[model samples]
Target chain A: MSLTRRELLKFSSIAAVALAATGCSLTEPTSENPESMGSVGMGTPAELAETDAPKVVIVGGGWSGLSIAKYTKKFAPNAEVILVEQRTEFMSCPLSNLWVVDAIKLEFLMHDYLQASRENNYTFFNATVVGVDKTQKIISTSDGDIAYDYLVLAPGIDYDYSEWTSDPVLERRLRTEYPAGFKPGSEHISLRNKVLDFEEGNFILTVPSGNYRCLPAPYERACLIADYFKKEGIEGKVILLDENPNITIKQDGFRSAFEKLYGDYIEYLPGSKIINFDLDNKKVETEFGEIIEFADAAFYPKVRGSKLLEIAGVAKDSRFNKMEADINVFTYEVNGYPEIYCTGDARPMGFSKSGNTANTEGVYVAKQIAAKINGKKEMPAWESPLTICFSAVAMEPILAISINAGYAYDEKQKAFGFTDVYANEKWDGRVGKNNGKGLMEWAKGMYRDMFNA
Target chain B: MKRRSFLKVVSATGMMIAINPSMINQVLRADDGRLYKSYARVQLLNAEGTPMTEQMLETSENYVFNYPYEGTTTLLINLPNESAKDVSLKDEFGEAYLWKGGVGSRRTIVAYSGICPHQLTHINKKDSFITYRKKGERFEGHVVCDGHTSVYDPEHGCKVMKGKAPQPMASIVLEVGDDNTLYAVGVLGPDKYHEFFKSFRRELKEQFGSKRNAKKEVVSTAVAMRLSAYTQEVIQL
Candidate 1:
């Protein structure tokens, strides 16, 4: 845990004055007033535990960052690793859909960052990164500046509601009121409340174009909400608005659930893009000239890498997403900056942006960073990140569909594509129950892998 | 790996005996488990309290036994053919070690830590994602963990044949006594016992009643039984 901003500012200023009085270069940070460092935020050194070991600073405490921190420390024990995250606690995004519908408790989605740090022997600094000094190898946070020998930026994803609406007021209203709930924390809570307190009329959800975070999540959310409505005997329906022509993933299973299970509760619309939104009237105009009305909606827009990549000067437009990290595909290092690495949802790769993908990819990234730390000349060979995702189609018994796949670089396409794809699209009878059990087990295993159980 | 009718599935969980931690701590402590160290030469007993010998083994079944530590479950398998010899393997941390194949008259018996070395997916009391697949199965003649689909070949010292397992499963060095009693002596390759204990502390508390009870080192003998009998739900993928 970190001190409040006010306390830190005062403490840092006092320390700076004390250092100035002594007139010796005692610390790595300059003896300047932290308030004077405008864009830099905090000029004072972070009040971290003193260590002479090589510092490996990681930004974000999500699945990717957490895994990298733990595995990097495990593989290279001598390195002093620190994970800088803005959030106080970690909330899992994978099984959070279950949490949204009251199928699973909030405790299941939440994890203590301090516990993860304590068990893994890394420092979890609760601070938001304000800026980075590439030349000095220092990342300035709201708390203070932390210098590092190696830096890993794993800021996940940011919602791009630009294409939906250019009006800032409309966008702001969308963000605060009817949020996409892709990111963890408040958005998820808001979404959960919106579903639980919902009484009647159509509850609209959208499937955004491009390789969005958790390809099947929107479909799963629709199904779960429809199931909730069906179970509660609520006079409502879920109008699923998909930009794509058909179901992007686990089509058979989701279609079956929509038809066989929640026929009256769900209205799945394919290739229906919201060209115009009438939030005032609770209606939206689709691209194919279909005007849809709703009582409530969660507009999940197109996803792009976090704006942190642009701030770090490592951003570029990828084939799939805009403003993603421009890095060597094999190694996660920034184009020319070997010491700086960018991973997780910010990467330009076409890998599925799910918790499982991030965790597996994080391990591979950790290996590359560890190799450099261990004084290895050559980085390890490129490894494929396994994407194992499970989507719930029902709630009472929790019938689900699953996908287990790995990626391989395709020379012809000059890009990466899913290989060894295994899909279990059966969500009926005992097989569905088994898949449901597998889903829970997979999640627990993933949680244990990322955190220290 | 389909669910079979478990007719003779025995429950011998009453045989759990806690040993002195201080005494076993000396032998259990290893840097990377690179050094082959011996423990209690416990006899492998089947469901009927009869010592398991060569004739009583099934080639297609997955057997379970706790070793070194109570929470650290291990897999005992009798392959259909003679196991390969002197298979070279590497640990997750890039340390290389040799696995000196299987034991018994037909050289078909092999044992490995049930816990996956990659993510520590193990044979848990509730459900086991890791188990042996029978002949003509998806991962035929291999121990497949459905969690991440990590397939380990018992014929080649449980070497990872597919999926994302960082290292091969740690081999349980077994020996046949003069009286033909099978005993697990030591472990070869890198073991995740320490990490396993550290990772599953919460589950350990629930499963064994306390962390200390779960961490209790195996001293005299460990009950060997079928995987289906050990875990309540043995999931198949």
Candidate 2:
């Protein structure tokens, strides 16, 4: 499904005529359809009836959706921006390792979207998006169907536990009982409390191979938990089973931290695949015919684009099942639908699936939409997204190691390539102490930029 | 000069003073003190308690003196006339101090918690984490967290004017001594230990009665620094 330049131009002409007939211009606020007026929260019906402005509907309120909402409202104040997120409060997956180890309180990680909505002058609907009707340019939500000139899908990721366990009963137990705490909320908190309570016993943490959100996070969790064990003087061992051949990212720092800090407490095994889980016995059987028993366990199952993507008819037939976005790279528009864009973790790009990348891409997509709406020619080339990842190595002294990478958009390849990449340098005690502090400072700025400003 | 231009001058001066402390004396000595006196009432001081004279402020534009006291750091900006000022409240510190507008010779002097309200990370002038903005004719100062850009306005008790901050930036109440030195007597709003201890001390005194000889114990600067550092680490984590 690819949109050619000629087809895009033809569509634009048809859209312009349609928009003119529907009175979706800067002069009028009210759309031709009175039904949409009741469903969409642009403003009071009276106020909205006065001016016809373009409407941008953003689904999901994580890093990407929030950023799009902010930037769209910023660039086009007259545009009616509606953000649809199911969750009432924003929870960050980045730096959640601190929360898991009980180093930080949950309150610090949660944020309300009210400020973002109010400050940006956008309407925020706490409603789940059910389906995207691209033909009608309307999205069906739990609240109602809302019309949109441009639709942005940032529904995040969902776990694919089918390969691991086919039995529905076992899968439900795996999700609820053993649990993977990747997604922020009650499950994360439960895992944290469980780890804290576990005394002298085998606690197993497994990491899935391939692309996952926050690549260094699983290792960071292991290090932080090991640090917790050392701090409480607990007699226990943490078995770290990795499906990947080796540490995926920030390898030097994590590898060194494991070797030097948690040499005795953590056992790292690579290329170990968990074929099946014996829920009755609390044990997992690896493909190598080795069965590992655990008192407490967390298994990160393979991930795919949220099921909503499949319903939207944008998901690719791949293992990870990401959205099939056009190769423009600058504009993350879906191949056949110029009015629709897919961003964040759901979109298949050359970049790693992380919060920072999602944020950068969200802003880029917003700008691209603005440019198109304003009828600007020659869209600017996208800059490479900056990536900064920090891993907490020790809790007592409160130490952390960091990786900083800056990317540049390659004109020839039409993809982002790393301009500068620094993995693990020697751990500086000062940076380690300061990075923990830096993470919060950085997160606050990011949240403000995305949601508030 | 217009308040915005004056602030630009002050910001430049602050950058110079940051590079060289001795430049403080030179800048202060060169200033006429009229504009400085009109814009800022209190003398900006370092953590070590050196009075940042008007000349130093006049010479440099971005003169932000980092003052570390009682385990936490406070950023003292010479609030320009264009900076947001509120004169609604009156306290025991006198009508002048209570209100944001200057009382007598002292101009409106305000200090904010160096730690960001959202995540307890330290906000500093060097990093541009905390900045003063002159939007058109309206003047405002905001603390910007790099992590999430949560902006807090200093005028309305450091309330979150923009961003993801849940609460206002903690404000440090200041008093000018007879000799024109600024003294931090109390803190109001967010951050943990300072607010906790301040309220705890007040409650204890109220319960024990005034005559119980509840002498205010001055915490050593080292202990305060340690506590501030510890608090920042814990809150951020």
Candidate 3:
């Protein structure tokens, strides 16, 4: 499709949102045509067997996109579902921290969208989404055009390196020089190589502000990297520069591990919010007035919804799309586009953009999409998603934490109070292995539900 | 019987995929070109080229395979000594991988990882040989992953017997330096072992054919009986 740069950015942003809607995973592969192109729909063939299948177009086959596709296939199996993703396979950002430590390979962390969505029985377009016209309910991709009854936006976050650091080359150098390895691919490999090469040097980790993917990830990264250094007889310290006062999730557990086992090797500089960086000097000047220099640095920059969400007029003050504060869930049909839904990291929910959270949101949204298509009146009672994260302490004694948040009306105070559900514990090593197995099964089951089921 | 028959059955009783030593040199070549080449010239580093720990050397002496969950490679370990006993590790499905005796003269027991070639399921040990089945057959007497029927040759470098799996069981190199102490030289794989022979294909076709022809019938007849025994233990959660 011939799309203008502006339209491309807009569509790319929406595609990002659609991708995140599926939790950064592509839809199941369609066996007939290897290039299973298009977006997620409300139903496949079987679910829409009785009712006329709604033509749902999902852009970007990442987590959020795949989730919407999965649920849609389940409840409305007869719906004409279309998923469009640029990548052939989906690589997870959840366990990516292990890739930085050479514990897991990138291939091991990736899933074939085509193979997974084979039985999904949808038109799969292995092409980049370019533009979407909500008025016409039509989305255009690199390959062709698709019409949709319901549009799901979840393209996932883009590295607005421009927002944090202006220089893409410098950003490239930061990864090349110090090995930040924030995003994926070579960056991860470089970071791993840098870590293995380092016998002893100051390793600095900085977490940028605003909501980002896997809030606890940077801390976990720091812990794993630190463990690697310690094992290698490296005489160094991992200095953490928090853009905020403290991390949002399991901050205490990370701090305890740092202090207890790696007391001599680790240091945390709270409120060391990095304003910008001078890549040449290898220095990041923070808002808290600390100019820190390091032998190596890993930066986790701030996150925002895909640019399409903003162009669609769904994004709020910051780049993130605003969620309805009443429920704190990021599921809404835009005023102009009533048939479309936005969720996940792309949706402006004041929550950590995590795999578990996004997965739960995807399931919830799927159920919602099913209800809407079935002509149900009342929207299902929206329950807050439970958040669970596994953080390995040197690939041993993996820690697990479950988190949930909800709204409750305080009649006595005539106001609203938050019912926060949070639990943290050290998962037994064997249990953690079992959890890994369980998660693998869940992925397989989820893949089946998206395609076969 | 011909000399080949005595050699055939006994040899068939234990299978090992011969690996080339140069593959290890290549991976280490990236780490430190000089050190790897130096070791390659000496050919002292065994299969994996990963430095062996004292614990691994000791374990290799008694058992051919030790499931060390803590190590980088979790499957088979090869011992350098020839006197070590042949043993098998089985999974819940009764699939097995053999941990054949010592690879060298150091009396060092080497254990290779028993993870299947397809999915990374740990190979189970049962009786004298670790055997894995697919659908119902003994998976042609090869190590088959329960998740997907990817096969492996444990005696060798855990080479893939069949299916889409490319990599082999990384051989844990067993070495005894001048100090008379056993050490894991390195891990062995196609990338590490393909240099020694003009790619033998590990004779997987013969191995698979022999096992399949010898026993064509399904063995899950016993597996169904085990499932019923477990049903009584469940209280309906």
Candidate 4:
């Protein structure tokens, strides 16, 4: 069951094209004995419902990966698209703030990856990627190694607690006890419990700096949790400790909501960076010598590209983040590795790391992959990824605000800039129930597009 | 074997197991200039139950009707100018098809599926985010979906004018009867009917009593009404 690195490398040297013809495989032959190195390398090859068609192995099943899986097969019908995700089922990160406060049911954010695969004509493989052999075009997963004609790596962001503390013990405690619920599943459940169980005390939440996942989420979470406290008549207050200078996006709407609606239940502190955390005493020290005591906390730290990028040897530190995919910014391909793409939040682009942006970018990447597979000389014209973000500002009526824009590449700056910007940061003053409806509709349409639900 | 020919066979025979539910939009322009099979011959009528003629339809009014299917919504508008002739259109999956211009004396009367081809954002009962924009509007003269800001040119076969809609809105073919009554006979180019049905089962059930009833193909007559009248809220962004 164990594989040495040399053995795995040896197995990858077999010409992938001659695998079916020469009857060569990574799968171990039938063996009655459980242990004895029946195979030269790792576990047997994954028993997939596969074909001789061009294999497109996409790792990650988030917004970007799902869209790429669905459209790549649609554009190139003969390509066998297999999406590898670690999670058993999909729980949407967007609109999860509403779910945390019980505004929407858990089922609202839950979707079946199996259904998506069936309808979209793709295979959903539930496995975590351990490493990727760039030379042999083989992805080493927890289950087995999968060969790909075209490989896409879209592992999302991973929280960076290094800035706060370098100690592994403190990092483990922070990760487990005060789970940043920004990720999907169990962390959200923990944060929800913290909100429901609070009697009357200061509940702490932190916002990180840089281009984080869902720029407006931390603010939205603060607002919704505060709204819940206000609605329940709890004497609790949300002490929002933001490392950033100010609210990141939809500032007008969130600021107004904080002042107008949850003024008493929420306290907005901008540059209060936590220098020391006394987890045992429920106290934290700010950078400017300010001592604050909290009943509970969910410490969100700065983020970087997922660790998988570094393991694959395709990672480079970007201006804003670390260990991001070292790929061509325009084409999204590894510098020397042709046909291997890295997308989604793992990308080093300064574009707002959100679901809509990733989904749109996924479609563009899918088209390019399809064009190559179909033997088209010219790649399709590059299109901008749309950033359509909706942030909830209030509950009861669930009023909200939104922003819609597309990105354009700048030659001089060597970066992407937002274009066709339309901002509607008007809530509680000139907004109605329609904006809330828009928020739900936007999520619904995005889910439908990705899952074919 | 070329990929196009192989795909043609796979699609025509409906033999592809994975993509069977939505067989790639078959591009068929028969002898009569029809791109798809003729569906229910639903006669467009006003809210008063009177047959709606091309001349009777007014410009700037957001007229809507459901044809071909019970739950599907189609846009019926009288454009201020003539629609372009024989516009080459591509579907979301890059299938090529042609859309003949509006079928009337002035060629100003046109119909397109109310469903936004980008993401299936359609005109619904609670909110109608997609509609034809008239003069004095931000996206004036183009059919705009405010949900994602995809604009379509109603006068030129609903080609994407701005924003990120992959294809033009699916065209709805109409014919003016000898007596001047308008009738929707078939859908032009490619559409999102299969995806629409699969995606909106919940909404369809709540709106139409059951999802099965929502998918029943339309029969002889369907009531054509105003976009505002069809939905309670038309939040113009």
Candidate 5:
């Protein structure tokens, strides 16, 4: 629909408020014309009994997997939706930076998947997916091989430990002794305890270069740890070593905070790539041949798609093995295999590999699948999804700075592009404090929408 | 004809059928009124209670005032007479375009939100907000963020001229009173500061009732002047 610039501004304001109020509920009315919504009644129980119905299987229970699982059923009720995830409990990595500094309890990040499965009316199997037989249309799980008419892979991300060393002993040590804490579990707890135990010494933090989940997080962790040190009156420095020359995203906001607020506490060293670590000496060597000693360290390793992508033969490279999806940007369908879809951090997309973006993509893909099932020729391209990130600069009064942007699909480029209007806008201090509070509300609303709805 | 009027006619006849009726109503309603609500109006006055004249502003290239509410500040630009031209600039939201050089026409006067859009650092003595200087031969003005050296061109719609700022600084909507006193009526960009002041004023009114003694003790002379100025601007608008 054509709208004047004035109308567009007003509409966007209303849309922003609506999105804030209702987390990720972007479903169009499906009750009126089920066929118009998508191909439906193709996966009914009676048809399943007759072996004519289609069974859609979604792997992983992370942000993307859970969202699509719920939305697939909502959009196409007749489809037999089954979610196969290894983990029973859902732990969010989005706001876990708050947990690192003891600002928020670890329990706040954990949620049960049982409620989400029951509410969405999808079969949840808490079993590891060992293999996928594309020819047989079956997923080999630890329990048994489950058949599927369609398969969606949203297996999150895994660290690329290839660069560190091939020694299994060293790999085991790196996993246990120096945890990345990117994944949510025991490692996160260990990292938190390490920060609490740290006292009056140089605590080094290394950030890897290239594509990783949550680009702004390492900088955020630095700020949070600095704030923690300052609060506890610990005469220590957070020496942040980055592979990139500077802060990748929201450069102005983070750089200003580093200089003005945490300059004395945080020794930011950019373009200092960690070549190797001397675990015995508690030292790290950069590419420039500078050996820095530290009391403790949290080395965030570079990430790639899970091993499942490589095993499934979808990944192109071994270093950063991300699945290449021959996707119709509007439909989110893989060109060759209409029944297979790849999304989240595992999929190679132009968009940032973020939880928010993943969640939005999950919804989009699910709707497209439903549309295809209901005999719809084509689905409309989604309005650019908004990704809102709040970076906490201080913890006492809870001051944070926010960077929000909306992405639109570029048909010519076949990629998602950010518009100048809503991109790179920020608010800090009291306004940011309010935004930090809003993050909690947003998380609550997001959980409720996904599970309770 | 006014843009709003033309839009109303076009929306009624052509676009109404294609668009949702509720959306049309919303658009019409928004267009009929000012986009932003006036939070506080501060009167531009010297220590002596006289209205600020064009002559007083001409002496200085830029005048900085500490807005009474929430310690937020406003930077007033006094354009050179010969160089002064009618400049129309769109706000950050692009909802409305604010026009400079009208009404009294003594000088092309404009105001900008003094807080840095990058980190929200308010202008102060230690870190001056805007510095006007001559670069070689031509005069140039820059809104300098003391926290970081993010510079914004004051004359060119407060656009980021240099440094790492993401967006332009917010524009403060000002009105020239009959007595030539500058009054801050509204702001067109980020209104978080305005919202804070509104809440702060509410808290003050709750603590101190209609008692003049409480009001006198609580409100500063600058704040009082602003409140009076805002009321006058509201009436004039």
Candidate 6:
């Protein structure tokens, strides 16, 4: 008898659990809900015995991954969606930045991704994906090798010290001792303590070589730290060591406010590339002819996709090791291989590697796969993503919002051009007395949209 | 400096009209040619001159007006002695700058602008107006900026006392209406009083002095910037 997607999900869940006890795999056929999943609860599990739905495998229960999983279930409730995440609780990276600053505690950042999976009637695997076989359309995790027709990857970023060429070992030593505090938890708290007791000296901040997760974050950190110092009446200068020639986005406005008000307190040293550092001396040697001693320094190392991307042969580019896909259209399939799909930060796109972008890509790719499986004539095209960033200078906060949409083909230039709609502005703290308030709201809303929507 | 100006004639006539020291009444009878007419009748109540009395106050559902002095023209309202509760009053600048939230030997609703003279931040009564009385120093009423912790002296025409706000707080005239209600009659300072004066309003761009590059505004910026820098430094420890 033909089983509907909902019935299949229910039966497969029982079968999945039973198989788990016996350590076996019950390879089942694909299933999906026939009615559009715009609204929730169209038919009961008993009536869902005759629908065909696609099977989706989502790796990472992060903002992007969980968001895709939840959206896929919402758009096609009968579809068999399985989320493979290593963490039982998903922590937000957006707000995690504050954890390093002691602005907020960790418990406030943690959310139960496992509970969400169960409520959505989707399968959850609390295991890490070691490999993805593109040819076989199967993912080999610590738990078991799971097969899937459609795959969405939002497995975030990782740091690399190799780019610091002149002094990789020294930089690594600093990290070993000081910790990056990029991810939440112990590192965040340790760093937060270091900032609280900071006294008279030169505090240095280094920007990463490539596209980091959040662009305006380091600058925001500087501003917050500067505000902290002014309040304590400790005399010092904050020296920003930029690997790049100039600051991007709110850097100009930040410089204006910092210089006009706190210029005496801050010494901006441009063209300072972290070629190497002497951890023993606590001195950093930059590309420029300057060796500086720092009381405190935060090095935002270069970032790239997860190592799993390289192992799966899903990543086409070696430099960043990201999947090369036609971003104009949502197609994650390898050349001539239509069954397998890739999405999220792993996929190479024109937009910056951001959590928001990854989440958008995940939903877009998931819908495409669902459409192919359901034989829907039209599918939503890959639209450009929107970005909202909040930066706080001193006590006042500013916000910038930008959206990218539309595409263009340059025939003469033999290149593709895109038309996009974008909007951005610095937060006028006058409107809202509190800094970072809107940012907190956006972070919460974005997280909910990704996982709960 | 018109010799026929109402203020000039009033000074020459030697009339001892006791105006609220904190208030700037621009209703000079000498300036009849001044393009604007008074919108409402104001009662001047000087807390410094006359002790607050219950008989001098008019209580309404929305507001309570204090008439300290009996005059054909009233422009100031004094607070009642027994009334110890916080009373908030919005200045002519549409900024609510005063709230009597602190307990003191005596409390008065001195006429002060809600706008921070240093920057345009609204002077919030809750955060502003708390001055720790120094030894041998008078406890000048303070006004705090909600945007920044800039404080101003309410008694000294809203001068910056201990904060980043550079300009002195402007004052407005308080008047009792026909219904015994208190209203903001006019503002102090030639620039402030002329801000809404029809023809003069068109000329006035912003009340904050543009040419005066005073160092008074640095108190807030300096403190905040120093604290932020210190936090960045200590966190490394």
Highest DockQ against the true fold, candidate: 4
lDDT of 4 by residue, A93-197 (tens): 999999888899898899999999998999999998876666556676777777678999999989999989999999999999999987899999999898888
Ranking by lDDT: 1, 4, 5, 2, 3, 6
Worst 10 residues of 3 chain A by lDDT: A41-50
Local distance difference test, per candidate? 0.82, 0.60, 0.50, 0.81, 0.61, 0.49
Weakest 10 consecutive residues of candidate 2 chain B by summed lDDT:
B32-41
The positional error of residue A214 in candidate 3, measured at the CA in angstroms, is 0.8
Worst 10 residues of 6 chain B by lDDT: B215-224
Clashes of 2: 38
For model 5, residues B25-131, the per-residue Cα lDDT tens digits are 22232233222233345566653566665556652255666552445556666654322333444333233433333223654566676666643444433334234
Q: Give the per-residue lDDT digits (tens) of candidate 1, residues B100-192.
A: 678889889999998887778889788888888887878889989887778989999888898878888888888877888887776666678
B1-237: candidate 6 lDDT, tens digit per residue: 223224421232333233332233443432522211222233323233342332343321011121111101111223233223333333222223233321122433344443344323221112222221222333222444423234554434444555333245554444434454334444433222222222122112233232122101111001101111212111000
lDDT of candidate 3 over A1-453, digit per residue (tens): 122334434554565576666563333323432222333322111111122457677776766677678667766776667777777767666677777777665665667677646645566667766555454355655554555678787777755455566777776765456554555556666777777777666788877667677777778888888777777778878888876788656766676777766787778787776776877777778776677777877676565567655444355544332322112343445544456787767765555576555655677777777777778897766655435455654554333332334445556954334465443433344433434343343333333333332
Task: Write out fnat for all predictions, comma-separated.
Answer: 0.52, 0.19, 0.00, 0.56, 0.00, 0.00
| Candidate 4 docking class | medium
By TM-score: ranked, best first: 1, 4, 2, 5, 3, 6
Off by over 4 Å in 1: A1-39, B1-35
lDDT of candidate model 1 versus the reference: 0.82
RMSD (Å) per prediction:
8.3, 13.3, 19.0, 7.5, 14.7, 20.4
- What's the residue-level lDDT of B1 in candidate 5? 19
**Per-candidate clashes, comma-separated:** 0, 38, 107, 0, 8, 58
What clash pairs does model 5 have? A38-A371, A38-A374, A39-A373, A39-A374, A39-A375, A40-A374, B41-B226, B42-B226
DockQ of each: 0.48, 0.10, 0.02, 0.51, 0.03, 0.01
After superposition, the stretches of candidate 5 with alpha carbons farther than 4 Å from their true spots are A1-53, A318-331, A408-416, A420-428, B1-237
TM-score of each: 0.89, 0.64, 0.55, 0.89, 0.58, 0.54
Q: Where in model 3 is the C-alpha error above 4 Å?
A: A1-53, A160-182, A318-331, A377-379, A396-422, A427-453, B1-237
Question: Please, what are the lDDT tens digits per residue for candidate 2 over residues B1-237?
Answer: 223221111232322111111122222211321111111223445435556333233210222332323233554444454334442321211111122432114354556666665534453322334444434321234544444445655555566655445456555545555675554444433343333233235433563343122222223121111122222232211
- How far residue B154's Cα lies from its native spot in candidate 1, in Å, is 0.9
Over B24-63, each residue of candidate 3 has an lDDT whose tens digit, in order, gives 3332322311111112112122234443334433322212
Candidate 2: deviation at residue A128, Å?
0.8
